[model samples]
Target: MLYVMILAIIVLVYVLTRLYFLKREIKRTTRQLNELNKNATAKKIDISYFDRDFEKLAKEINNQIDLTKKAKAEKRSTENELKQAISYISHDIRTPMTTILGYIQFLESDEITPEMRKEYISIVKNGARRLKILLEDFFELSIIEQADYPMKIEMIKLNQLILEVLLGFYEEFNKRNLEPTIKIPDNDIVLRADHSAVKRVIENLVVNAIRYSSGTVTIQLEEFNTSVQLTISNSVDQLSEQDLNHMFDRFYKADQTRTGKGTGLGLPIAKSLMGKMNGRLTAEQMENQLFMKCEWGN
Candidate 1:
């Protein structure tokens, strides 16, 4: 009977020792968790627990901490982007508005001749048209971002479609003194995409080329093993790598000074539309030349 009682005491002591360690580990982990939650300066959760279960719980809590930090970073990035977009929009609107106002004031001048009056009126009209186009692009971007916006994707012969878009821009090209060298496959290059979306992408690229090109514009279509790349190459007097990098960013202008008249939303919208179509739009700069490439996956 004495031996049995001693055995019982030993068992109880072992269990109580384990319980004591378990409670200590739990307390330490709780303290670490509370510290992490309260202090933004706490970069990581630090705890040493002998219990495997407590260690696992610490790891899970750390994962949550990491997720929270990442979410906060993303929120800050979005806020900065929103601020930049607002600044760009205001600058863009103000430029054309200032021009319109100046032209109107000139029209009221007493010494203005008939030819001068006609020129002032024409300038005002152009400024109004530019403002209208910018507003429309903003609206179109919103539509594209809508989750439930219906898209009609079908098998489109991209080569033929590109030709049609180029033809439509013939007058604009002539006005810009740019006769693009176009190379396309005689064979039908068919892909599944939205017709209107593809057309808009091509048109935006062509317009961008016309606006920024210095010497010649060469547009080419080539098929790779898994995708087709449409490249628009143009010569520029000067362009930086930074410009190439942010060219597709919303409201990012190569000429940040706002000397160039562009809404700066064209490339961003085109990029977003391409993403919706499971494609990509990228840019590169080579020896005073800029190339905008649109890739469509097969």
Candidate 2:
């Protein structure tokens, strides 16, 4: 009977100690939760002692907390982008609208000569044309970024297609006396992609080069064992690292102050189309030249 009593006392002490630990753990978790709620801190709950069920609960809570924080961060980022888009849209649209309106007002003056009148009309027309291009680009970008954008896939001959695109601009180049040097391998590079999308990408690249070139532009097509590359480069006197970095970003005019031409959406649209076709588009600046490169796997 004495031995039995000693064993029973020892068992009771163990039970009491375990209960005390469980209670202390619960209190700690509760306090931590209260602090988190009060301060919005990104902290996980701490349990002083381990219990299988309690540990699992803490793990689940931590996971949920992480998820919630991630969601909040993403929401904030999206909100900021939306705000920027709104500002850019307002500024760009307002510029052309103001020009068109101001020119139309100039057209109303009766003392202007016939040549001046004709010039003002042409200016108004150009402003309207620019506005149209801007709106179309914005609309097209939205469509291309959609997940369900439809593209007809086929084998595209890069050599022929690129030549066709460049030829399309031959007249303009001749007028400006800025014809670019072209280099391509005799062997053809056939890539399985959306032909229309590829043509658009190439067109944007060529137009970008011509628009920014000082007096020279170069177009080159090369093929590797496993990949094909297209490089378009032009001389630039005032290009900066910041310009290179944001060259692919939407509404990123190299020098936002220079307002002569370019919708600033061409490169962004090309990048989007390239991404959809499993291709890569990148820009590099070297000394006084800027190169835009597009690569695709064979």
Best by lDDT: 2
- Which pairs clash inside model 1? none
Cα deviation in Å at residue 86, candidate 2? 1.8
lDDT of 1 by residue, 191-227 (tens): 8999999999998998899888897999999998999
Poorest stretch of ten by lDDT in candidate 2: 255-264
Q: Using TM-score as the measure, which candidate wins?
A: 1
- Please, what are the lDDT tens digits per residue for candidate 2 over residues 1-298? 9999999999999999999999888888888888887876658887769889989999988888788779989999889877876788778888888998998888899988999999999988888898899899999999999999998889989999999999999987886689799998888889989999999999999998888888899999999998899999999979888889889877778877536577888999999999999999999988898999999988
Which lDDT value does model 1 have at 131? 88
TM-score of each: 0.90, 0.85
